[model samples]
Target: MQGPPITIRLLLLMLTSVALMTVDHRQNHLDTIRAGLSLVVYPLQYLVDLPSAIAHWASDNLSARTTLVEENQQLHARQLLLEVRLQKLYALEAENARLRELLNSASKVGEQVLIGELLAVDQDPFRRRVLINKGSDDGVFEGQPLLDAYGVLGQVVEVTPFTSSALLITDPSHAIPVQVNRNGLRAIALGTGEAERLEIPHIPNNADIQVGDLLITSGLGRRFPPGYPVATITEFEKDPSQPYARVVAEPAAHLERSREVLLVSRTAEEPSP
Candidate 1:
């Protein structure tokens, strides 16, 4: 029993001496000894790490097919959804182009029309203006009229080198001359800063205008073209003894929601006086 205990003690002492020598050689001024020991131990390090590397490679190889299949399915579904949307967009664009062509022909004024894309709406809800992707270079001028496919949108308020700002007809400061299409009753449609509505001020209480009457630009001031749709009478209130009637009309064009518009050039062919 004494002999076995002495042998175990000697083994422990030898292991502790080796660990101390390794630490000193690696950390202190013994590079030559450290390099030699590293070369001897390098094979064991590789052997320990080899199983983990092999397992990782094998796992990737086995899952590659399933991963590819799932990715392919997702891509195909996205492609199908985009294709359907594209088809509808194409049809809508074609219809818009045809209607614009007819409008240009019917106007007979020969004004060169430039199509502009809406860039942004004003951050202030009270101000009804939009930024467009056209400017002086595209023949857009300040005070030039803008219109959508349905009717008048607004006038150019600010012109820049690359873009311009349009004040919509619903702006609080905007007003346009309009005539009721039903009975040719002329009135001024004033913007109330409401999103899709305007107010007709100073109309007599017994005016011929009805709740469903259509209002079109009368072209009296020549700011807007005549016969262009402006608004539709939506609400009207008349007090028997009041001096003026209270009337509200909804705009015919998608003033707040329109994404595309035509910037009518001010250079329309003038007829001889």
Candidate 2:
């Protein structure tokens, strides 16, 4: 016998809930159970609210203009540090390249060269000369050829016991015999009394010279080392009426800014002991 109808089941469920509630209230039997359940849920409630606390702290930190300024200053300092290191690397690379060229020049000349340090540049506007820290005491003599890492610069003209003066190839009174590196057409390169320019005064209008010819020492005067660079032709002009071409060149040496030079004692340029 299926004992109860649907309505009867529902009526019985209501009466049992009411009787349980009345008993719990009279005896306080459920109080410990409710407290135990509250304790278990407290940690979850705190966890759900943690996001708001973190957001409030971050907002306060970002609101201050002073904090942004401090961060920008730190970034600038780091950038400057890197730039300074880059400059040092550039200097080291230039120095290494200059040393390599000096070694090559020394090998090609096949002479004993004494290193000369610049003491002072000549102040006279009419002369292109410099004083070096080598003299008779260092075996330096007049007409001794001076060169830098690049090429022939000048010859020592006056010497003291401890110092000497070199007249640059750009001096008005200086001249060197040179030949075209490509064809060996000989000419005399005369200084223009300027620090940057030289001239070949008597070049034939139809000479084998070109605008970009290299002029190395021709060993004609024997004052400069043969095969050493003297200048580079930059311009060649010929007038129909004139018999010669006006050839101008730039000095191969760093005439305006050399800090060091080599004093080569070739057989013909050196003074006898």
Candidate 3:
């Protein structure tokens, strides 16, 4: 039975809602009842929202973790690059030091000198030779003298347009004229295919040579300049039955380790006294 018109029913419902709101706002008469209703509905509301809350939390945490990992990897890569650069800087410092030594030696020789870098070392055990970057194009010629900072290294044996080969003083086929610095007794130093050994053959049994004597170039053969160091006497042996004494010397130049060397000019000035 429709006892009331639509307009009358709407007005009555509005009046009832306003009366309940006024009472709840002033006297708080519906507080307990409202609280009980909220308690009953809270679990349903949370249940409906749980999936979205979980999704938001997981997305935020996972994204933050991914960002941190990426940043860490980038930092690690940068550190490795810096370390490599540092190592290169160290190598450059050592190279500069070696160049400085070569320059000083050049100045001491008081001659026109050209600097050359070693390209390759001879692999043959019997040949102690090295290839250099300087060649005939750079005024390098056969029999040109090569010297390191410490002493005479060798002489150029072969020259090309862009490269040259040097026979080290330790090669079995190499020989240099050297003299004792103490008494000026001249002798020939012969290589033995050993890095550290040079033999002084034809020394008389009564020769005045002694161990620890410095051997310098004697300006003979006109190949190497005078007064340049060659080696130091290390061992001397005399056999009464033999006319010559067996003498061994160690090279002054670091043949096995030098990376740069100087080539003396053909008309080079005399070395400093």
Which residue pairs show collisions in model 3? none
Model 2: per-residue lDDT, tens digit, 1-273?
898999999999999989989999999889999999999999998899889988987888777667888889999999999999999999888867776777777777788888887899988888889999999999998999999988889999999999999999999999989999999999999988898999899888888888889999997866776898999999999887999889999999988877778899867555443
* Model 1 worst lDDT run, 10 consecutive residues: 264-273
Q: Quick one: ranking by TM-score, best first?
A: 3, 2, 1
| Candidate 1, 126-198: lDDT as tens digits | 7999999999888788887788777788899899989999999999999999999998999999998988889
What overall lDDT, based on C-alpha atoms, would model 2 receive against the true structure? 0.88
Error of 3 at 142 (Å): 1.3
Which numbered prediction scores highest in TM-score against the true structure?
3
TM-score of 2: 0.65
TM-score of 1: 0.64
User: TM-score of every model?
Assistant: 0.64, 0.65, 0.80
Runs in model 1 deviating more than 4 A are 1-110, 267-273
Error of 3 at 202 (Å): 3.6
